[model samples]
Structures are given as C-alpha cells and as structure tokens.
Target: MITVSAPPPPPPPQPQPPAGHAAAPEPARGRRWPTVVTSLVLLALLMFAQSFRFPNDSAVTEPMVASGDASAAVDAGSFTVKVDEVRFAKAIGDGAEDSGLSDFAPETEYIEANGVWVVVFMEVTATEKQLTTFESRLDSGDENVYASTSWLYNTFGSVDDGFPPGIPIKGAAAFEVPEKALKDPVVQMTISSGPGQRLAGEAHVKLGLSGDELKKAIDGAEETLDVPAPEMQKV
Candidate 1:
C-alpha cells in the first residue's frame, strides 16, 4: 500500500512501426540536378570560348586591289588619296618646260635613268591639319620595289609637309626601275602621322594596264617630261 505496488503495472509498451515499412525517409536530400546542370553548362561555354583565336595584325595581307584611275578613293586614316595619272619617261627635266641645259648650269638639269622612269600623279587631301610625311614606291610584278625619286630633284615637291585640312594637293612621284619590271606595276603610298613617326597606314593603287599600254609607255621613254606644278583644290 505504501509503495502503491505495481504502479500502473508498467504502462503498456509503445507500439513499433510494422516490418518492411520504414519511417518516412528524411525528405530525400534535395536533388542537385539544377546545380549540376548549371555547372556543366558553364564548363562547356568556357571550353568553346577558348577554342577560337584572333588573327594577328602582322598576318593581315594587303587590302583589295584598286585601280589607279578608279573613281574610288583610297583612305589612309590621316589622308585620302587618289591617283590621277601614270606616265613613263627615260629622263626627267628640271621642272621647267622651256628651260635649256644652260638654265640648270653647274647642276644637273635632268635626272637620267639607268632603266626607265615611272611618274605617278597623285592628289591627296589631308583629314587633319598637321605636319606629316608620305612615302611612295612602285611594286613590279617581278617583286622588285622601286622607291620614288621625286625628292632627289626639284621635280615634284613632296606631299610630306604641312597640309591644310579639307584641301587636296596634287603632285607627282618619280621612280627609276629596270625595264623588265615595268610590265605590270602597282603604286603604293604609305602615310605617316607626323615627322619621324611610324607609318600609320597604306593605300595601294593598282595600275591595271594591258600589254599595249606597257608598250606605249616604253615607246615614249625617250622623251623628257617636265614635272607639273602641284595644284590645290577643295576636298
């Protein structure tokens, strides 16, 4: 009586889950499909991006071929230029037309050529009002390069000087190259940003001439050409 004996005769044992029926599995760990797919996609994109490479500037070849007499203009960033005419001669006289050898006495009056002389007439309009320099060369089909001789004598003043914006200056460039190299030629002009500066860009004017044209130039090589004066015009 004092111990209340037997208490409640040990409360009945708690019921256990039925065999083969497990307690609800912890909410199946969240499926990682979304995160896994996102990682795979990012990896694929990265691999694809690394497969391509940009071309090097040095590897770039010359631009499209342009005709010397083409109405289209050649743009060289700092200046826009056009080739007006192309002529050839055996010798170049002292800029003056009627001047005799005596007029240039003491100094050589004409520039004699070992082969033939190539003269290119060009018009250049400066995009910027600044001092700059231009270089020209004649490229032969045979891979020969003939530099312009316009600066050697007083023939045509150089386009490489101070230029006024929106004004075009017309001048001639001369080169002496072997006769065999004259078959098919191309004139190229390189522009410099300023004196002693590196070359900015180049403009190529192709001399698309037939065999007859080349023959005509060669036939007239004996005559002397008077260097024409440069004229200015509106850009």
Candidate 2:
C-alpha cells in the first residue's frame, strides 16, 4: 500500500543518441568484395614484370655452324677453312728425325696407353684485310672438350700466328685426349679477329670423323710425322 508505483516505470528508457546524430547507420556492413578484388589485381601485375631478366641456354639466339664433309672447304666470317686430315698416334716425334731438330729427341720423352695424340691438319685463307688468328679444339661425341697440345712441340706452323688478307696458310694442331675419345670425334675451329680478341667477329668450323674411320686411325702403328712447314699462297 505504499503507492510508489515503481517510480513511473523508469521514464520509458528514452533513446540515448546525441542532439542531431543518426547513430552512425549501423556501420554500413562495408562491401568487402571490392577491397579483396583490388588486392588480387595488384599481385598479378607484380609477377608479370619479372619474366625477362636473364639469359637462358635453352634459347638459341645465334646461328651455329654445322659439321662439314671431310676436307671440304667451309666459309667462315673472316676466312675459309678446310680440315685436310686427322691422325692419331701413340707418340708424337719432336720433328727431330727429319731436320735440324735431330739434336732434340727421337720420340716424345714419354708414352701412355690411357691417352693418345690427335693431329689436325687444316688450311685457312683470310677473306678480309683485318689481322686474324685461328684456334682449334676437339669435342668428343659425349661433349668432352680437349684443347690442342702444348707439350708436344711441332715444327708445323702455328695458327696463332695471324695471317694477312687474301693469304692462305696450312698448319696442324695437336691435342692429347683420352684414348677412348678417339672414336667419333669432332674438331672445332674458331677464327678470331686478333690473338687477344677471341670472340670478336668470331666464326666456327666443325669437322667430324665417322666411327669406322676413327677406329682405323687409332689402331695404326706408332710412327713419326714431320710437321710440314707452313705454306702461304695468294688467294
């Protein structure tokens, strides 16, 4: 019977928003799809800019010269070349048996069965007036590379000695390679603009031997080959 009436039901709990505000409209549920799509587009563009930064061996941008017929003339950029002959021997003489070299030795001071000597006889003719040099190497079928021999001295003219324009010179390059590589070998000749400029205006010459031909050459008896003096002729 106190008749307080519960304090008029607490004034009906009036709304609490300030004077002129609409309560921020429930924070707008924010689309979210536009932001996610923009982030993915930016990531795709970044990956597209990184593809062309380096060289790949699988791409061949330059032309390669193919192997030519035996003793056939092939045209290089600065010169014309022909592989005249190839010989395999157990030992290479110091050219002493033929001439003034007699005071040196009868045979190479050493011999080994695990390896053999390869002599490449080539003729080169300069096509231009520029000073040019020649280099040679042997590539086995398995892609092993062997440089020409520096130990076995030869009286034959050196390709390193550059040639003059329109002049032809004949010489031999010797390589000491594993006996097993004697079969199906390819000889590569590189002509350069100068002794120091090995790649400038470079040209390549490739020569290969048939399987039967290489076997016969390797099975031959030991013999002494005289390094033929360089012969120069006008083109």
Model 1 whole-model lDDT (C-alpha atoms): 0.68
Best by lDDT: 1
Candidate 1 TM-score, true structure as reference: 0.63
> RMSD in angstroms, all models?
9.2, 12.8
- Angstrom error at residue 89, model 1: 0.8
Model 2's lDDT to the true fold? 0.62
Worst 10 contiguous positions by lDDT, candidate 2: 196-205
1-235: candidate 2 lDDT, tens digit per residue: 6675655555777787776466454444356667878889887777776666445643332324544655578776666677787777776644444457656655545443247777777777777765555566777666688877655444232534666777878777777788776556776766656444433333344556657766677778365555544567655
Error of 2 at 27 (Å): 45
Task: Report clash pairs, candidate 2.
Answer: none
Model 1: residues with Cα > 4 Å off, grouped in runs: 1-71, 97-108, 150-160, 196-199
